[model samples]
Target: MKGLLKSLLVLALLITSMSVAAERVHLGFTVHYTLKSSAFSAKLDRVVVTKVNQNSPAMRAGLFPGDVIELLNGSVVAGASARKLDAEMGAIRAGDTVKMTVLRSGKKVAISMVAGET
Candidate 1:
């Protein structure tokens, strides 16, 4: 009975560990900051899409290079720092829905994508 209990415990632990393992998300896009500089402080002007990988989630979602990011997950991107944006991206997990509003050719466009496995 003790041996059986130990085996069950081990199985439970293994299952728990597997379930606890989170899958990182891959957006398959790259972005660069557009900064407005001054004598005192450099402020974030915009976040622009630098590249979109072929067949990636970003590409599939209609994101294009030169598109200026306006919103992320329904939040304004204008005042957000680069570190904060990176942290927010890092927090995204696979299967999470991501939404963005971008400026393309002076028009605002919405893009939606599901986070995919890294």
Candidate 2:
């Protein structure tokens, strides 16, 4: 009986956590990067801008492929993983402004874009 009660409590908690994750908002863009190790580690060697959807916030903000992302909202992303970056972006809601620093052709550029639904 004690084991059954414990199992039920754990199941309930898992359901609650799943529901919360389902409510997260989309940041309307996809980011791809090169990781020297695993996703669990914060060791991204390069953040390559692979795609920018048409009419999306990133495209509207002039972000294009071949641009390397350097910072997010004033935080350095040099060693941040793809998952970590996705989580940080996922936490933002639509209409929220995201400030990003990027590198293009050896030049550093800063851009601010509003988040939108995918």
**TM-scores of all candidate predictions against the true structure:** 0.74, 0.69
* Candidate 1: stretches off by over 4 Å: 1-22, 37-42
Give per-residue CA lDDT, model 1, range 38-84, as digits (tens): 67544557877777878877889999999998988987878765445
In terms of lDDT, model 1 sits at: 0.69
Clashes of 2: 0
So what's the TM-score on candidate 1?
0.74
TM-score winner: 1
- In candidate 2, what are the lDDT values of residues 50-70, reduced to their tens digit? 667677677878887888889
Note the clash tally of each candidate.
0, 0
Report the lDDT of model 2 for residue 43: 63
